[model samples]
Target: MPSTSIESAAVDGRARTPRFIQRQLANLHKAITTNAKIIQDAIVADTGAKLREAQLEIHLSISVVKELYDNFSVEEALSQEYRVARGQDWCDRNDAVGTIYLRPQSHNLVYSIVSPLANAIAAGNCVVIESNKPHQALSSKIAEIILQHLDRDTIAFVENLPEPPSKGVLLIDQTGEIPKINASSVHTPGSSARVVALVDRSSDIVSAASSIVQARTAFGGNSVYAPDIVLVNEFAMKEFVQAAKIALSISIEETKGQDITASQATCKIAGIGLTEKELRGSGANVVMRGDLGTIAIVEDRGSSLLQRKIYGACLILHSVRSLDDGIDLANLQYGTVAPRNKTLLACYHFGAPEAAKYTTQFIDSYASFVNHAPIELTVGPAAPIGFHPSATHRYRPAMFSVPKADCIAGDSASRSLASIFRAEAKAWSDVYEKQITSSLAPTRQKAGKVVGFFDQGLITGFVVFWVPVIASAVVGSGYGIRAGIRMTRS
Candidate 1:
């Protein structure tokens, strides 16, 4: 286990005052503002994040914290907001969600620490964050600033990886610790824990192209979100292929010599299946050319992107003659299947006459939300645009991989991942059953009336942290329990 330590401000065991809470919130705002430069410096020094990227991540984190502060101040959480929306909306806007844990990894110090932590804090849950990465000094500085600003009860920025000994309501695991999340597999029967894995697809062609050109290629072709393959539709194949070729040139030109060399080297790797022409292109990793178009590896096969919640770029070119084909293709890709409102983006000449039918068919079929544009669907939470369907619910994050890994590479990745998930599910199920029995089992166990079931946060947290480390964990862990009258209502 990593070494753990606490910086205690209180000498006695007593809790602080409400006035203190207000003061702390204020101080937190100030600390983030004051340490802006320090934080930026620390992020760049600790990790290789460019000064600009560091600044944005830090800024966003601060903004999220501020949003949380505004919503969760003693007054706001107590005073309920209007109840226009029901369960989903209620959960979305409420602050009573369980505790949240934010653990950032070493390399991308700023993102790992800030993104999850800020989002958790914004959701009105008490937060405990771990800031021990490659840049311990920077992390420590950040922790110090956070601690100085927030109230002890609402937020705890800890130096320990084990956390503050307080069972997390939920954990935002920065480290890819899949086994810990899926605790029930090999040892037990069923799994109570659930996890949400976020993967930004490089298959989203428009966004991938934009990222390559606009976003300063911070991750090179190494981003998990970088397109593994451009699945072109039949209708858009010719144009998309031409555009893609051009885009590859632009990417190579922009990336200069960095990616093209990798692309060439990748072609030479045994069974990599890269074409000489593609090797001469900008895309790195394996580049396979086919009748439809090309599938660039973007990065090495099954790189770390598969493990982390990909929030970068993906460029996929899909040409479809019919709407059904589009949906089939989407599902074929094992797409995240998010609300159409949040899933698709319209780029370049996408909304034009040629692409318009494909776009309209998708929105109509999926019933997505469309603010503007012709062919667009929302994938995640950023925003919904274009002709999105009215029924904009049922959105989940998409997961994809790079290089057309044939039977060997593909099966290798899948089998290992599947085995890990299976083990984890079994372990968690046993623990969850035990908790239920203890909670409702006539004996007066301190576990209390089974108000509900499972730590919603913990379930999701486990998934986030443990899935990749052990994919089998996802297999047997879907079991859940319902609260009974024997349980006291909260």
Candidate 2:
């Protein structure tokens, strides 16, 4: 498709009424909900996801469309449109970006595409999706549903994005590559971004193990939100490892009757109980391997496993000395001169509230969860780069729009420009001289007893030295007087 077609469609999208956008979103929701079963089946067939997982993906996709539809109100839209005309200020007003070009990932195929697609439509932007993976059943099904429900002119699907992409296009790339096109883009770091989990000594071992295990094993464990490597407090490592073993066992048992795809089965490492020395040569020790996943303990600090993101159903564990140690390890980049900061996709801090706070304060991640990884994140594309993830929605409507505030009020300056222009030089000079001549004294603070460690140590030393000397002097004086009294009596 030519870039001109997309540009023209964007022009038409901007001209659409709020009512039309709402109706189209509703149409999408109905179509998705009506064909929920087919979509779920297609997801499983294409991705080899379990039936239950596929069902959840379909459910989340429908919810995305429904939420956008329900939040949109024609009356509010009309009010926003006429606010400036009525001589009022619209503080939160935003205009839709002209066009949204989506390059979606295959992870959770339904939710990944539907999320941005719904948000774009709801925000009144034309959409152009890159759906080149027709070999996948889920991709074809999604393209079919979208084309059947949405207006043909407002949306288009191409095998590839137009080269030298049109200016002012909003590109949403979930495929993880930073597009070289000339447009504003939102793209995930893809497999390069890592999600880390910190298990403090104060954390609930069982709960942390359960949550991390489930996250690592769900949907064949390819989720971007899954823990790439867990940093467990050294004191808690023993208990955490035991808990994780039990959790993994229970998870595997739950899926015993379910079909295991060849890809998922291949993720399991054959030999268990491999010695640390033997694995140290290879960088990781496999503690246990099962049909569902493998649990490995990282032995090397500079291991590639610690530096890169894990894409399979494997859980990697490493021990840290303390919360600060965990932060250091989390920030460690194998070959970089400086530690990684603000580069993690997300951090799951499983510990007491204070420990969690400390971990989050020092470790920079795009999003931080205290104890549990929200299951919703496992279903959608990683939150777009430079945008925070929503608790409810995967992609927010604001991400699709740009701030275009409608302000009618005048600036709140202390003095009017006309008044300044009319003021005499003597008046201005007097004001300036008064301001400069005024005394600027620092405020007094209340005095209190010094209670720092060094101060306390000094006080303790004084008492320790003087008490012995004073007691000895008194005792010597009494002994001398007693001796003198006895001699006089004799």
Candidate 3:
């Protein structure tokens, strides 16, 4: 286990403060930037991710740290003004959501964990992270790095997710296995997902196949965002499949450069929890590099591939009767057949933009890329989200914080952030002016229930008891407004 010194530090009163949170984040940033190469090498050695992929994880991790430091501020969070259209008659502020347990999905290791970790820190909450699966070792290294910079209480790591804290926890389970919603999920479940890539007759078969091939073969099918079952218009099936095979036919020597031994590639494919035979059993045609050079392509009808999250280098090409049929099938697969949003991503490559738009409406997915696949080859730690429906919240610092409303109800008040700030300055100035003058202080504004009256230097008010009125208004508003579209130009 990594040192729990930070956890030990948790008992200190200051550990929960915003300043300590900022210091922890700054130290984490320093560690990432200082030891980027060591972390990258560790990820590669542990995950079998290519050098570029591992490097991307490290690069992204550093960027997220920097982004969090620049954006999420403790002082800023406390003072956020939820300006009401009623023009300062009411307002809201943010309260720390409280200590959050960040459950990072281990599939992508650094990429998955770091994003939420940054947010949790920014929200000014101590976080306990739970890491698991193939990336457990990588998780430990991250904890080790974090420990060097952060005190134990500010951040801690556990082997498994515990009972939810009083404050909400970030359940970053990319596997779609989070029993209930936590903070977020970068990858939803694919156990029942079916990919539908529409390749019309007029579609660029070569481009479609190339992108899909790259997505499928890229990173050895670990990417949940990749297409599992491509829905090619029946008229273009043969051409698309042919193009796909050609795309995967890149030289064996080139594939060999990835440094995977033939022994691993030729494994009973059964051992990896997925095999071509099972996929073929569904009436799909198999195409791959000779002697199983890593890439595997299966051509089948849409019905043949459903609810199967295949691991390894395999792409499934399925035929659809028509674009409408494809859309309906895609819709049916994601809508009724699959639980939750089974399809994480759908890529449509077609000449008819209108018809493609119709397909996306029916296909239940987090994101759909028109004329493009969801495989991003950028140099950073990343996950496919924000564009699609996710079970988890956006990887933002705010999700870790609670918003407690500090409402000031009045008929009139400062109308803008600038005005309110100016008033606050004046209030402080008035206090100093009285102190220097050494005169009997003016009757301070006495604000209270039962119509209490008071006056300040520049302000006066009759404080009516607002308790019962507000209580009734809360219930009255429900019955007061009719449900309909109403647009107002404030």
Quick one: best lDDT, which candidate? 2
Could you tell which candidate, 2 or 3, scores higher by TM-score?
A: 2
How much is the lDDT of residue 354 in candidate 1? 39
In order of lDDT, best first, we have: 2, 3, 1
* Best model per TM-score: 2
**Clash totals in order:** 67, 0, 16
Q: What is the lDDT of candidate 2?
A: 0.79
- Report lDDT (CA) for all predictions: 0.40, 0.79, 0.59
Residue 243 of model 3: what lDDT?
84
Per-model TM values vs. the true structure: 0.45, 0.84, 0.68
lDDT of 2 at 406: 76
Is candidate 1 or 3 superior in TM-score? 3
- Candidate 2 local lDDT, 412-458, one digit each (tens): 56446446546998777777788799998877777866698989999
Winner on lDDT (1 vs 2) = 2
Model 3 gets an lDDT of 0.59
Name the lDDT value of residue 123 in candidate 1.
42
